[model samples]
Target: MELDRSGRVLAALSVAPALAMAGWLMAGLPLLLLGRFAPLPMLLLGVPAAALLCWAGTRQAGKVVEATVWQVAGVVAVAAASAVFNGVMHSEQLIVRRDPATYAQYAAWIAGHGGLPISVQPEAFGGADPWLLFEGVGFYGVDGGVAPQFMPGAPMMFALGHWLGVPFAVPAVLGGLAVLTVAGVVARLAGARWAVLAALTFAVSMPILYTSRTTFSEIPSLILLFGGLALAHDALGRPGWGRGLLAGLVFGLAVLVRVDGLRDVLPVLAFAGLLIAMRRSSRSTGSARPYGALGLPLAAGLVAGAGLGMLAAYLLARPYLSYLSSSVRPLLFICGGVLLLTLAGTAAAPMLSRIRLPRWAPAVGAGLVVLLMAALYVRPWLQTVTRDPVTPEDRRTFAMIESIQRANGMPADGRLLYFENSLHWVIWYVGLPVVVLATIAAAVLVRRLLRDGTPFDWLLPLAVIGWTTVTTLLRPEITPDHPWAARRLVPIVIPGLILLAAYALSRLRTRRWWVTAAAVLVVLVPPAVTSIGTAFTPVERGEAAAVEAMCAELPPDASVLVVERVTGDRFTQLVRGMCDRPAAEVKRAGAETAPEAEVRRLIERVRAAGRVPVVLAAAPGQVAPYGPATHVIALVTRQDERSLVDAPNGTWGLGIDVWMAVAR
Candidate 1:
């Protein structure tokens, strides 16, 4: 029984995710155990683990599971192409965004210092002060010490690259892995050809490209999420304790990366439970008892595996949980509730199997459940928008939209309208036609899954695509930037939609190869061209250059005060991360005094520490009191107002004046 092309592709696809997941998990263990995550250790442990998993999968796969050389080559080719494309588009310099800069610094510290710093005091001006808070660096000042606000998953990966002396290695590698995982899953569910197409579509997406270049959480999160889904699919097909446990572990690790992943993977738990419940339904009475014996261990393995995964995530992320105060309770409830439901469902599977219903009954129930969930998720956003005086965050976003509209010679009154149309921002990158088609394809897939009791391999993809699409469209709370806000959709929704579209195309009954090829090109070329164009477009370098100049003019041991009236604390982190300066921010808080008094106080404090004091201000008035006594080291003047759509909290290309107070 030599495997056909499709069988071979499916087999390879199943094995790939488990191998990747095992590799990442094995690689990360040392970080947990030794408090340092390095590439050499990761590869040393991970490669062997992956190879062993591959060997095990192959041995158990029997004669019907053999990927051809061409099939393997094709997957690798797509992954390599994705890696190259993302590497080329990688940011030449870090942008004004706080998160990416912070994550980079976190990685740098881990790479250089071997663990999370006891205090980011080294990066603080005049050393660590119990009372002083570091506003922009994204570190939590708690109990007289500072800790990184983000989870360690992304930083752990970045530490590997830093170890290798490659700045962009983490994103490049993870981005390629994400593409490969999507392709592999698509191959397993749809076919080998669609897998290739899905990988290409994801590689060319503008949002994907933009994210791949930066140190964002989405890429790493996607790697875990997709990898988990692939493994879970394999487990569903194989129905073994080992496979189930591995899937659970991968899913759990995803939560460690992004807490929100707990929401993304709920369906997997339900799917696993369903599999357990139905395992004995198809067996004969003679074999029913034997099958029932097998089902208990399978169910227990899955539950135990997932429980362990969640427990590991909680232990790893306990420190960062403080920063996510609002989310802690809900996340705990969701995890707890899902585990309980899985146990209950597994326990009651025999009873559930005895109950029969109309074919449409399950579909109807699922639809109602999805609607209720969507409504629950969207309620807060709806309430927010309906408020009389818009929230401060929304107000700022609206103002930015109005400014962009005014610049483009469009009506500035469409701020609310823009917010409403934020859901359609996907159209801006992939085109309206593709979005519409994908929506239709999504609908078709959902209908098929509900109507036909498809296997887990088929059901999981549709569930992911459908769930992410609905959630993204209903709750696009991010600022309505053309391609950037669309980033919220990139990790799952966009790629999922692309796969759905590819699957839809594959279903077409056309036998002509050219016809299929042309259809795929037509669907993908527009976005690819748009993404390529954006990739080549130079990043705004003026702001970065001005920062560099400021760093150069100031003394090596300068304690800089960023006095930002509009862009508060944004440049503080950038300066600290990029220029290796100990920086702080002076905002509307603190004592109200004359600018001269404030400048004198700041200068005296720095002078007491034997470091020079510098002020970087967004407005001239903020620095006016310093007078001619202060040297104007670097000034950046922009003709237009900086649009805050992409980075709502930060200002990019904004006019800035840098001043250095003359040392006494």
Candidate 2:
């Protein structure tokens, strides 16, 4: 029977859900069924799943049902293939780098408690307060409020992992699914071949691979970003307030996933704004659609507000809103306004009509207000909390600026160590240049679209550019640090850059060679450097190896005293290993927190315990102020070995190896 166009579309949509479900089940079943008993099962399952998806997606069906079936199958195939590869190999590395100890502890927590509890785990680590901030032991009963650093999407993802009886690596599998879906959607929007290229590029790209494997919020944030872009793209294809609102909803969800998540909202706002601009620009005389002018912003604001409100509600109920005050409030408000304005302006229209510069005067006023707030609120708050002036010498700021300067090849004393080695942690390893290049490419495409209105042109690049802006700006020098910004931003920038390149390439239809070469240069350089670095010199591997070596030396009865400037992962690992047995690391006759004198007293108590004292890491140039009675045992490297010694005095200088007595 020949189906009508609407009938075909219905048929296509109707069959998609089943195909999607089947594909999902097929992709994850191996991991779930084998339960790490056989990695081969996962590899084997991937082949048929992928083949089925490919076959179904490629098949020609006159009706929408057939087309949709093909789409679902293709998406499933890609996702399943990626999942199998990720589940078998990359997930372990991600887990190790991001939260090796946490996963181990989670296993222990499960064993001890027999299951996860509805409330927070009393003994969980990874956040400030054990009971309030951490809901460890994998997935089930995890409260979104527990991990202030992690977006709710990832943990909610992990919760599914717990439900499915999969390892912590399972979240990476889910992330792969999102990545694959994004590529597929992009491909369909562009072309199937283009989709495959994008997927292949994303898969091989170091930044995407690094994020896809980790349990960090970046992957989930990217998923939300993609979801928003896809929704916004669909909304633009057919304009309706409901579609715009739906776009807003996706954007809101993105922010709830991560504050940087608001970046994806830009295209939604921009596209809407462009519509209004087109409408106004089409008019010959003065307009009375001022209320219409507010439509896009109002929608975006309500959506963003809903997201913020949801997060605030979650935080307030959890007593987290108090984390914001005069100093911090200003930053939040500024970030919120900037995010809102960017989204609104992006959607409002490209015209300089009714909603002119003066109406946006409030944003300028808000900018001044933000600056004043930063000066007044942040300065005093920092002084009070830091108990020192916010100067160049301020350790945290000094270390942060130093790291950035170091990456840029500026002079630094290197005397003070960076917190979490965040300087190297982000720029060097995360490979931010990828997004930066993407930004240039996006700008090129945006300008092209401005000079020439190309349908389907504005959506992807605008979304990406918006996302890139958010990613770049949201980084703040604070306690938690903005470590995930690079990865979270990658999804934004890469797609944006690629879309821009696609546009640029389109422009070079007659003269493809030179333009194509330039486009290739744009895409290749950042990721190439990143790829080379990751392959040749993996920081996570080196760091993990050092930490593993340290953990190996912890004797059943021995206590580890970390000194100097070992990374946070190093200390946290030592604690997890020691805590595995009641008295391995911190269990001693006595304990003390901070203060040199109190620590000295604690050292005496360890002497009383009749156990050998071990110092895990000594920061370069830091002396423990130990009395002469304290003797040096063996020096422990951050890698858990005794071969490396502390730097002597300079930034590279290690600390001393000290024990209360040779014999306790």
lDDT of each: 0.59, 0.40
lDDT of 2 by residue, 223-269 (tens): 55554454444444344555445445444555544444444554454
lDDT of candidate 1 at residue 459, scale 0 to 100: 70
lDDT of 1 by residue, 524-545 (tens): 7867766654665434335545
- Count of steric clashes across candidates, in order: 0, 30
For model 2, the superposed segments whose C-alpha errors exceed 4 Å read 1-82, 91-150, 188-190, 238-245, 263-332, 335-394, 397-411, 414-467, 470-485, 507-529, 532-664
Alpha carbon lDDT at 416, candidate 1: 47
Judge candidate 2 at residue 649 and give its lDDT.
13
Best by TM-score: 1
